[model samples]
Target chain A: MSHTTKEKSKLLARIRRLKGQMEAVERALEAEMPCGDILNLVASVRGAVNGLMGELIEDHIRMHVVDPGTETDSERAKGAADLIDVVRMYLK
Target chain B: MSHTTKEKSKLLARIRRLKGQMEAVERALEAEMPCGDILNLVASVRGAVNGLMGELIEDHIRMHVVDPGTETDSERAKGAADLIDVVRMYLK
Candidate 1:
């Protein structure tokens, strides 16, 4: 089973929250809210999405790359660290 | 008028696309796809969101901060640039 299969419920919950956030943005626009207020909403949504991405990436690293806690291979550990750095930069 | 009000259609279109992307992520998880594929879907959604945030941030700068084209105030220009830097860091 894929790692995500194990975390399906948690991941689905996050997606549902994201859907709600998108709906909130729609409502804000419909209400013709101020730009600053809308910006704050967008910022919150962006933060949530980043949080979700971080969770998925961490799981990927643990399941696919290296667990880090129980890993004894120096090369694999370094590779996992490097992959994480790249993912962070890309997500940024 | 808020800058977003002027760009409402375009912004809403982006949001709609984001909603679609979120649905795609849900479907992928439900289908029990591999973690790597799910990661890619999440990455795409992240990119779409960052694109939307960038648009909002740029408009915020142009309308609220400084136009950068016609602004003669060095202080305001510097401030806008600094705000953009901070935003980029936060979004990352």
Candidate 2:
């Protein structure tokens, strides 16, 4: 089974939250909120999105790249570590 | 600047790749590809999406949660580490 399928409900909950955040941004825009306020609202929505994305990526890494728990292969572990390192560096 | 904006071109490239993968899935469906093959194509798209999401999350962490390089505040570092731990656990 796909990782997403395994965690479908949790993923959906996060998505729903993201949707709500997006809707908030939309409402702010519609209401002609101040630009700064709108920008802040948009930033929150983006952060929510990033959180969701981070969760998915971590799941993908576990499912496809390496399962940190049972992974005994050094090469594969190294690969996963490398990927994580890149993620950190890129994020920085 | 928003991390996304700072890395706009790179992000766009990743998005373009994802779009291409999605288009391939669409094409496979239209061409009556075997179910297994279509499923594989969909998986590829999902992985691409996961990659993109992972990058965004990392960026968000760097921009908002903690800048690993210059994070001098122990409390914030702990908070970020806690978040990363949760991310790893959830992903697993």
Top candidate, metric lDDT: 1
Q: Per-residue lDDT for A2-41 in model 1, tens only?
A: 7899999999998989989998998888788999988988
Runs of candidate 1 exceeding 4 Å displacement: A69-92, B70-92
Residue A39 miss distance in model 2 (angstroms): 14
Evaluate candidate 1 and give its CAPRI docking class based on DockQ. medium
lDDT of 1 by residue, B12-81 (tens): 8878889899999999999999999999998888887887888788788989778766679988877777
Encode model 2's per-residue lDDT on A16-90: one tens digit a residue.
555455456455545555444644655564455455445556667777669756789988887887776665454
lDDT of each: 0.85, 0.58
DockQ for every prediction shown: 0.62, 0.04
Q: Alpha carbon lDDT of residue B17, candidate 1? A: 83
Q: In model 2 chain A, where is the ten-residue run with the lowest total lDDT?
A: A29-38
- Every candidate's CA RMSD: 3.9, 13.0
